[model samples]
Target: MSGILETQQLTHIFPNGKAAIQEINLSIKGGEFVIIAGPNGSGKTVLIRHFNGLFLPTKGKVLLEGEPITKDLTEARKKIGLIFQNSDSQIVGQTVADDVAFGPENLNLSRKEVDHRVKESLEAVGLSDLANQQPHTLSGGQKKKLTVAGVLAMNPQIIVFDEPFTGLDYPGVLQVLKQIVGLHKNGHTIILVTHELEKTLAHAGRLIIMEKGRIVRDGEPSQLINEVELYGIRRPYGQNRSVETMTWLS
Candidate 1:
């Protein structure tokens, strides 16, 4: 129960009978900032889907705080928020505030409570003023922030991010990265999946590298990812991209 999550012999096979991930054994402690790095189709997404009971393992069980994933995921998901990479796919409302309120509303919270969560989450993401703005009108970085705010409004104990920086400019990428650090400092357990090793190494406390549906290495970011080829994993971001450690500037 101490660890936020635990998986035993987790395997995920598509309906077409192709195994996306096989025999994954991982444990994540509370308030840990763990990032999963792999190439495209490495099953990072599939693996994360099991974290909050989105996808059950084909041959094993996923434990969230020692509870097995089940049909009624409400109790478990309240503590584990999953933030997709695309805001458009996740957003359900027109305005930023409305989108942030969706999750709390579904939880059956009172109107006033939902309002407070929306306001606080927006402010945390530095988008308090954009509450009235339409999600489609916001920039790529702002949209990502809105998506993050939506997840935060749920008041989750742990958050799973799937490639938070897929299509963003330099500033846009920095914006999400800043929020990640801020959330971690605020005592939120974070598991982020990304392909950009340089950006990830800059913020992640622990790094996990996966290849061919299994974790080849897991340790401090500076230790393993710096010498990726030593573990037989592909280099990311155009070969040997490097960045020093940085927290949010403002």
Candidate 2:
């Protein structure tokens, strides 16, 4: 199967020469939902940034559909959409509808097309009712959904979510997880950067575990999770809860 995205010998370093990513190579297939699992400072965010051209690789290349991603960025970014960890950083316009329309607007799409995409994206995330409200007025969960809607409006082939479940309450986390599953059902290539394993392992087809800036394990989620020591750096959700914990295995 052809990969939708590929990285060859990928590495990143700060100006001070602290390596964040080290000699990584991975191929992400189309229509597959893959999660990058690791503890903080494992370079998960840095890796995703390369996908959208947010951070240039210091040592290797990022290829989109087998070709090197162009430095032009507009074209490269059009193929891969990135939803940031902070919802506030991605939102632009005051109103929800306008904010969601931002990406399509950059594409110079027709007003009708932009409007249609804005409405459809908002509806996909179950935020159609909040379209006219100000982003600042929406709850943290709503803002995250709004940012995701904006990314969806671009209709990119792949979506990279950086720590999406962070800071959300239980209900909010479920909402985001469901939206992610819905996107996968619709056949978008999904790359999720998260420390939370259980939610993603249950949902994603593939799991890549990292340690100290390198991919230490990459395989099916079922197999990877069983190797507890390889993934010990990150803990599963509800580890302290007894009732919901045992139910998952059965």
**Range of the 10 consecutive residues with the lowest summed lDDT in candidate 2:** 241-250
| Candidate 1 lDDT by residue in tens digits, 1-250 | 4476988899998899999999999999998999898777878899999988888888887887787867458977888889898768998887999999999999999999999999999999999998998899999999999989999998899999998988999899889999988899999998998876667666677888888788878898767756676645455554444444333343
What TM-score fits each model? 0.91, 0.92
Candidate 2 pairs with clashing backbones = none
Model 1 CA deviation exceeding 4 Å by range: 230-250
Tell me the number of clashing residue pairs for each predicted model.
Answer: 0, 0
Instruction: Please state the error at residue 222 of candidate 2 in Å.
Output: 1.2
What digit string (tens of lDDT, one per residue) describes model 2 on residues 1-250?
Answer: 6588999999999999999999999999999999898877888889889987889999999989888896557877887999999999999997999999988998999999999999899989999998889999988888888988999998889999999988998777877887888888899999998877666667677889887789999988666665645545555645453222422222
